[model samples]
Target: MGTDKRTIAVRFFGGAGNYANVLERCFTYVLTDNPDEAALFEWVKSNTRATSDDGIRDRLRFLEAIGLLTVDEDRVALTERGIEWMADTEPKLLFDALAENVRGFETALEALLDEPKTDAELGAAIADEHPETGWSDPSGPAQHRGWLQSLGYVERSDGTNSLTDSGRDLARRLASDGPALERGKSYTQQELEAAFGTSFGSYIKGISPRTDDDGALSYVIVKAREDGPYGDDLEGDRFTYIGEGVPSKGDQSPTGANTALLEQAEGSTVPVYFFYQPADSSELRYEGLVAVVDARYVFDDDHNRMVYQFTMERLELDHPAEFETIAASVTDGGAASIETADGEESEPALTDDETEFTETQRRVRSGAFASRVKSAYNARCAICGTSRESPAGTVDIEAAHIYPKRDDGRDIVQNGLALCRLHHWAFDAGWLAVSDDYRILVADRPDLEGYEEFSRLEGEELTLPTTDERRPHATFLAAHRGLHGFEPAAER
Candidate 1:
């Protein structure tokens, strides 16, 4: 073995799909149970589905490859990093171990940031970048993608794979210790503080979008939850984030986080990092380095109070050409609106032309196309027969384009499937597809972590509509299969 380059090999482990939790349990067992080599094998066989002692040894070798464990002829023990992981058991500790010890781990993740890549393309990029790994064919890319998938770093969609928000954050963090610049990635509070080299002061009471002592804007954090009391809207990939202030309170003053963001709209040079925490989770996702395109105070009927709202553009993502033209108009002269303390309105930020532009670009999808597909499938997921209906009589079923609208696929019923959110995302991501014979076809990469459930759905018949005309067209299905690389049963 080369002393510098980490060797690439195929090592199978029974409970590796969710390796972090699985390894944490295994480490705890080793520490408390105090099992010797033979006793450990017996414990693994009893506790997990590991059927043989050889398979358990393979798992040990896999751990050893990542520098988490050491296995001798008669003894096994955790390394210093492994012991640290055992103490904390955070997923980042394990991920850090992989990046430091395993060659190409960071590179493999960074490759997915640009766009989705096929497994072969992803592997080839890693092998090409770090030639010292000597990785060729089956071993190089497959194991890397699988490990990333297991760790919830990469997600497959629309016939190609890309990094998940968490994975994107990890890739960015590893690439540079400097300020985070990537949009749509996520970071913990601690991670953000480390990246910025400053404390946020306080998340509970202090104003978000914290300002430095010199009054330079640090970053903006939004609790942008859909179900939250405050309203936040997204259009053309731009977010209209609610400014700081409680809804139950009287009219909000343009102060604290709100003022920090307003200064950007008023022509500040500093780039603002936009972070959002969902209603369900504490993880603050980085929206991007944002520019405040528009900001204003508006009356909220629901909360019966006046609040400041900032319309932000994620600098990295594309926007409509017309919006760019309108933005130039706003930047040239139009002043952002604000309500004075005496309850008077100021000059509106958006001109009449800009308002008309926003209205025109508000919705791009056809409601009729969505309705027809859902009605055809009885508003249920074609794969799982799942349907989500709120008490307000609205269903959560989504209409998926079989051949994809971006490729000029039509909005007709034959090219659509009414699916639940999970199936819709899965189908779009190439994790699952439907065969010509109306059977479900899952991606065959079982080496990927957390693939067991999806793998089990392979070859399961799809739930089709009653009439032939309403069914998914064969041409469209074939196109989807070709896009996702799903071969027919005979080919397998």
Candidate 2:
């Protein structure tokens, strides 16, 4: 039974670590002969010398935490999910398959799962495993680990680890067939140019995926004088006009000066060019022109349904007379009529009046105060080095106040540090705190065993902002330490 079970265990985990090996062995032992704690502990002790009784207990606890096993008094049994997960040939395979379907993280993940190491361990191992694959940085493995963990391919507990059922299935699927290589498939610039033509290629320069809709993108091209209604005078306007072409909701509209000009030209039925000159500048350059298009032939891009391209058959260079008529009509004739007849008596000053603050005003005031605190901390969270953007763009830290606003701490800039949200909550709840010199401290708790990521953050020096005067207040730190009953040495 032991030999058969060992064979089954090896087949189930497929060259995993000591903890995984132990769990499989335990499950096999339990299924073959229902063992009590004493018997199970003895079996584990004899099988793996690297794990102590306490280590074994912790491993079991970790498994229970992950819903793989359950313990009642001294007896332990495999969970139905755990039993099914172990019995399955390819547990992590589904995650790999899904990851393969997406371009970004799956390739790195497939490589990592091929070996059964924890993220940190896997990151360290990647250099040795595939030194020739060009991704030699230590962060490569770390990022892969984070990606896999985020995607639920791997589960970790108290420094021990196990492959999630999804990860197992993914592995099996990849083993049977070949691993997906979606990351290797991307369109090159030359390929794109060949496929879409030069004009279409130029259109994609400012194109981006539309925020409000799925399956649609947006393109904002700089329209030349030959393309739209304006000419040399309005050429330099940064926001030539604001328009939205929504396909899903079926709402399309053009607005601003362009729309106004387009409406004026509709009366004459003639193509016209429009131009606006800055009062301060004398430079004249061709801007945009409006030309009649065969409405039947205009076709929008498949990727960005909002953008349309039409064939230009003829070029016309004159402004329609209706433009001048419309412009003159809307020129505020009343203002032109009101001649300032040499300094008429001015109106008297209005008296100051008391007013109640609206809810929006109150919130705005609160946000303003929070901004001041965040500025004081130089837009960085004091506990962790989380900034607006990491060098790699992975972590984004936010501004957080050390003292709660309800506790009478002023919402001034002096009270805030830019911290990641997690660290902000930790600092507020007293699970963590900063020293006068801005060093980090963590509360002592055994149950936070799995929180190695957070635990490793303690005692690390904070990355101060560029300004020297924006340092955290010593008075605030002293008061906090006094209230919390813990103090650390100050920074040099």
Candidate 3:
């Protein structure tokens, strides 16, 4: 009995149409036999009755165009890259066909090709490129192109065109390996510390993840270092709160005492740090202290740290009204009451027993505090308008002591404004002052030029806060001007 060529053709083409069978057979024959063009054509004609000479020639030319087959004169051979490509696509219809079905591999292949084509180019080529397959919706191919671009197999040049090289290599590797590669673990201690601008040892020790066994993905409890020692203690041994579970692997539930200690630490003002001694005797540490300045100030890694450090505090102060509004809404039902020394009821005072700084210390701290407040309010220097984009970007700015620390001017939030170094010096020297309504004033210094800019600002109002409640205290400003030997700027 004759070898069943029709059965072989049917087996290859079954669900796939004529074109797929032709391409697969061509690939299989070329790969196995290493034949030139004329020989390959002759072999195809002898083996398969459906392949016409003209049709065979056209397919070969198409393969050459798409870089599947290379030709030298009348001779044709698969290149080593082409052989690797064939191996990369093995059994013809399995992965490559599936990739084309899923849009993953096809997109990757398009990117690997030199001079990537645009969507229209790809759409036009799809019929010729995937000749055996018929697409009912163009969107499938279009979506595949997008998927390829996302996977880094194809890059868009200009705005409309796409191409790839690295993506092709990656796709091929992924297809051969069956898409089960594990993602690499997160940063080591040194790496995490470098990224976060704080010690990882301190952070992990302070906060425990909400889910004990699930790693640090959920809610966390802050550790209290100053609140005294933790764990059931009496003997001099340190009972590390590694987690709610066992010190060794086989243990499931954490000891009862450790759970109680963790529950006590949650939502407390005091920071918590966590230390874990692994079963392998390796130690892992993390810092749990989080400073809520502004989103800008909280650095996650090196790329974001510098920007955060420079702008976070300023952003926080500038939008104090917003923060206050948020705080009010959240704490409305549980507002802390304040009691004056004269036994009068009042709103919560800024200073209390729990406050970090004393009144005298707050006065001294006002100079630095004011600078930070100004930096946030102005978003840059108030004078000379020095901003992040300026050539001399780091021009020194100070938070001029509106009320002098020596005179007991309070370091409270309201008595501050952003000022450049020059303006700060001028203010300190009693060369300028602001009215209760925030108008700028020039001192009666004969040496000073007091140009149109300075004169214009004299009665012009400073930018007011979004919330009226946060307006600078007129009494505080008046007290500052009086102490500084300057009359207040007249109201606009």
**Best prediction by TM-score:** 1
lDDT of 1 by residue, 1-492 (tens): 235546453334443246555667778877676666887787777767788777788768778877888777566678898899888676677777666666777788888867789878888888788777577766567666666776788876654778876676666555643463356776677776786677766652223565567875544544464465566785565778777777667777766667766655533234455566676776676665556655677777888877777777655522222222222221211123366899885633211232332322222223335656777888788998988753222466777888886665555677788888888888988888887788888888789875788888888888888877688766678788888998864575
> On residues 179-222, what C-alpha lDDT tens digit does candidate 2 reach at each position?
12122133333443352233344333211111113532111122
Which candidate gets the maximum lDDT versus the true structure?
1
Q: Report lDDT (Cα) of residue 147, candidate 2.
A: 38
For candidate 1, the C-alpha RMSD (Å) to the true structure equals 22.0
- Each candidate's lDDT (Cα)? 0.65, 0.43, 0.43
Clashing pairs in 1: 156-429, 157-429, 158-428, 158-429
Which portions of model 1 miss their true places by more than 4 Å?
1-3, 9-12, 51-55, 72-75, 157-160, 176-492
Let me know the TM-score candidate 2 reaches against the reference structure: 0.27
Q: What digit string (tens of lDDT, one per residue) describes model 3 on residues 401-490? A: 466645544444455555676677766777667777677776655566755445555655565444444445565577767866665455
Question: Which candidate order results from sorting by lDDT in descending order?
Answer: 1, 2, 3
Better of 1 and 3 by TM-score: 1
Where does model 3 exceed 4 Å of error? 1-386, 389-400, 448-457, 488-492
List TM-score per model, in order: 0.38, 0.27, 0.29
